[model samples]
Target: MNKQEYMNCAEEELLHTYNRFPVVLERGEGVYLYDTDGKKYLDFAAGIAVSAFGYGKKEYNDALKAQIDKVIHTSNLYYNTPVIEAAKKALAASGMDRIFFTNSGTEAIEGAMKAAKKYAYTRDGHAGHEIIAMNHAFHGRSLGALSITGTRHYQEPFEPLIPGVRFAEYNDLDSVKKQITEKTCAIFLETVQGEGGIYPAEKEFIEGIRKICDEHDILMVTDEIQCGMGRTGKMFAWQHYDVKPDIMTCAKAFGCGVPVGAFLMTEKAAEKSLVPGDHGTTYGGNPLVGAAVSTVFDLMEKENILEHVQEVAPYLEHALDALVEKYEFVSARRGLGLMQGLVLNVPVGKAAAKALEEGLIIITAGSDVLRFVPPLIIEKSHVDEMAEKLDKVFAQIEA
Candidate 1:
């Protein structure tokens, strides 16, 4: 279909749920996308940080196809080989004993929250079931995750959310310390805050969370949905800090584009938390997604994905930093690895729209930060193309 056809379908027939860019992505390859009009654009957003191994990875395709031929969905009531194997790989990589798979990132957050509070309640009592999250942290859109999102805009419309939730300043050790009372059950945070302008957790702050959780006997949960799985030049972002969360939630790039989410917990935490028949979904951990997930982890091991990011990230960072010098609108560039953000003096949405019109795909976060989350397989040449297009976009932005 053409762009006009899609626009008509969207404006007339579809629900006004998303604030989308004025373009229809028809097809994609590694680091590039074709719009409905056949215009090729340098894809820097990577489907909002989902296409981990880049578009059209043969191994992932093969794994998925093989599973599709066998069985796609056989209700979660019985055991399935692909799901079991995938669980093994995901659990091993996460450094946790047990895991519960879900359909999306929000479901993963809900499961993690339930497990955290359940474990705390089972251990002592229900009074100590409070959850403390960071300000500007984005977990997911589910009611449970939204309850602890710490963003007023996403929470205002849906009031009377989950109880025993409080917000603390991100990367502030003192804020965390003051909030963790006797009622605190889980102290949740993103290893590298993705929607909070790509701010990584300070080492001292993470270590402080670990110490405080230990002292209060509360659960430390890291939401690595966007920052995990070699995105930050590490398999898990928490590995950058000297902290191992009692529970961890991850999704987005886990299946290399397939919809899959997982939450893992330590033995003590898992023991008191989830049990058989306590929670599940019909499609969660289905064989098809399991095969794809197994393939992704296997490739992550053999290909040394993090090492590749370590080599290529510096060049991309330098290129984006150079943009700040050339364009007055770009204020700063910040992030650890591939998940970098371009903080702008001008409005990020306007700059992103300009980039889209100029044959580039980018995203915007809170405030004026333009997000750049290209696939990890992106090379220096792709980075150069992105920089040139984004430079023009920034130059055209009204300052």
Candidate 2:
């Protein structure tokens, strides 16, 4: 069907959760997406950082096709070879001891929260067990993840969320220390805050968190859903700081477009929390999702994706810096590697909309930040194309 027809059908049937752009993407290749009307646009959003290998990579496609031919899924009750392989690779990649696969990032967050709380409950007897999250942090939309999310507007609508979740200022060790009580069970923060406008954690801040977690026995949970899997030129963003989280939640690019996510924990936390029947998922680590995940990791290794991201990321940051310099309304550029954001004095949603009209796809992180989370395979040429389109869009938008 045509773009208009697809959009009309979507409006008629689909839930209105997203204020979607007036475009229906039919297919994608490399860093470009084609609309149903055959219009081409550079995809800087990377399907919100899920399409890491970019759309239609031969290796990724082949792996999924091969797996589909063999078997799609079997219940988690029986062992799946692909599931074992995927879990091994994921554990190796993140340097975490144990993993529990889930269907999405929100599920990962929920699982992490449960694991942390359960561990605390084992010792603290379930009384006053609290979680401290950061101000401006965005974990997920589930009731558990939403409780720890710091934004009031998102939480205010769903009143009386899971209790004992408190917010602290991001990057401020003092604020975190102040929030800590004897009842505190875990401290969860994003290694790089994505939806809160691409803020990378300071080295001192992460290190301090590690120290506090050590001293107080609080689980340090880092949500790496948006910034992990070589998006930040490393296997995980926490590696950049040289401080490890006791538990980490990863997704988005984890399955390379397949629906998969996981919560990984250190051996200590793993042994202490979530005994066999505490939590489970039917499709979490089934053969289908497992194949997609293992293929992503295999391709990352075979293609040297981490090195490519490291090499090309500077070009992206340089181009974004140029925009910050040229546009008076553009205030700053911040982020690690390809997961960058251009802070705007104007509304970010307006700027992104304009870029979409000019054959470019960008997204908003917070209220006034344009997020640039392109595919890891994008080269200097694609960066130039994105910057050029963004420049035109910036010129059209008022401060």
Candidate 3:
């Protein structure tokens, strides 16, 4: 069937959750994707920053294939080699003492909340502990994750969400402090806010949050789901600020395209929270995703992905800045490393549709920001190609 036919079929059977683009992506290689109509697109979205190693890496694919032959899954009741290896590498990378794997970023957030609440309960011998999250922050779509998400529209329809989550202003330390009370057990924020536009947390603001958490004995949780795993030229964005979170939630590129996520905590938090029966998942740490997670970390080291990002990210930032300078509608460029955004006065949705027509795949964040989160494997040439395509897009839009 053709692209439209496939889309029609999908629309008939599948729930219409996403206002999907017209193209039907067939496959990807390196930093490019191809649609069913045999059109090529220079990918800047990286499947929303999940394809760290790009489309197909021989090493990563071989690891999954080999693991499939050995064992695809085993109950959490039994020990598995791949999960054990993944746990060790993840712990070392995050400098956290304990880890709980989940199937997605939302589940990781849920687990983190549970751990924080359990820690508070264990400490005070009571419940009803609250959590403070930043306004405009986007955690996830699940009930527990959505409750902590600060956006009102997303939560209004799903009314009466899990209560006790207070919204604070992003990068405003005073706002966070004002929300804290005896019942505040945890503070959650994205090290770099993704869906709310590409706003990197200010160093002072993140450090201040850390200090507040330390003084108040509250667990600091950084949502690294969108900015972690070498996307920010560091293993984690919080590392750049030298602020360690008591609980860190990671996904996205953590498994480099596989369905896996984890919430890691310090030894102190671990000792006081989420004992055996407190949390469990049948497929969370199964060997299939375990192999994917372990191989992702291994390839990150063997290929020096972080170093590549460090070198190329500045070039991307510079190129985006040039567009801002050249175009009247382009207002500014903001973000860290490869996760950048170009703010525009025009409609971002129309611009994105035009980009797709120009054989480029880009996405938007917030309402007016053109989000550029290319694969970690992207080169300077890919950035150049993206700039060229965007230049045409801007020109066409201006016309």
lDDT of each: 0.87, 0.92, 0.94
Q: What global local distance difference test value does model 3 have?
A: 0.94
Roughly what TM-score does model 2 have, to 2 decimal places? 0.98
Candidate 2 achieves a global lDDT of 0.92
- The most accurate candidate by TM-score is 3
Residues 143-208 of candidate 3 have per-residue lDDT tens digits of: 999999988989999988998999999999999989999999999999999999999999999999
Better model by TM-score: candidate 1 vs candidate 2: 2
Candidate 2 lDDT tens digits, 265-306: 999999889998999998898888999999999999999999
TM-score of each: 0.97, 0.98, 0.99
How many clashes does each candidate structure show, in the order listed?
0, 0, 0
lDDT of 2 at 27: 97
Local distance difference test, candidate 1:
0.87
Candidate 2 local Cα displacement, residue 10, angstroms: 1.1
RMSD (Cα, Å) of model 1: 1.3
